[model samples]
Target: MQLEKDSKLELNDRSRQIGDVITDVESKVRKKYETHFQEQEDKIAELQRQLNLVSARSRRPKRGRKGKEV
Candidate 1:
């Protein structure tokens, strides 16, 4: 009857609201994780660059005393 129809409509509205809230929360979580991953990647890249510079410098001979003629 009419009462049953009204109940169904109310249930549908509540379900829709719950779905919207879930979607919003999921979007926020994804954004936070994406930012965290990007920061980690940037840190790794910076560390790699510093390691390369140190390795390159170490491979070269010293200039003043080491390079002097015997």
Candidate 2:
């Protein structure tokens, strides 16, 4: 009976350690993905800003010399 109890305790300890390691690895992966997503968001925002500038320029008239008298 005592031997069985000792075996159970050892198994529980090993299971707990395995769970802790898996949790740690999961946390790191989650953080890496979060950073990757943030970088993508920043890139998308920059592209949007550039697109707006191009559109604004296209909507404006040419400055100097279509030659219809000053």
Candidate 3:
């Protein structure tokens, strides 16, 4: 009976250890994905700003031969 109890206790300890490892891995993965998404968002915002500047420049009227608006 004592041997059986000891075995049970060891099994429980191992289970707890496995669970802790799993939790640590999950936390690391979540942080990595969060960082990746933030980088992507920053890139998108920069691209949008550049596109707006180019569009504004393109919409401006060109000067004619006498320096008048074409």
Best by TM-score: 1
Q: Show pairs that collide, candidate 3.
A: none
Prediction 2 TM-score vs. true: 0.76
What's the ranking of the predictions by lDDT, best on top?
3, 1, 2
State the displacement of the C-alpha of residue 27, model 2, in Å, after optimal TM-score superposition: 0.3
lDDT of 2 by residue, 6-66 (tens): 4556777767767877888899999999999999999999999999999999887666587
Question: What is the C-alpha local distance difference test score of candidate 3?
Answer: 0.83
lDDT of 1 by residue, 1-70 (tens): 0123345567777677678778888999999999999999999999999999999998887677778634
lDDT of 2: 0.80
Model 3, 17-69: lDDT tens digits are 67877888899999999999999999999999999999999999988999999
Q: Candidate 2: which stretches are off by over 4 Å?
A: 1-9, 65-70
Residue pairs in candidate 2 whose N, alpha carbon or C atoms collide under 3 angstroms: none
Better of 2 and 3 by lDDT: 3
What are the TM-scores, per candidate, against the unseen true structure? 0.77, 0.76, 0.75
Winner on lDDT between 1 and 3 is 3
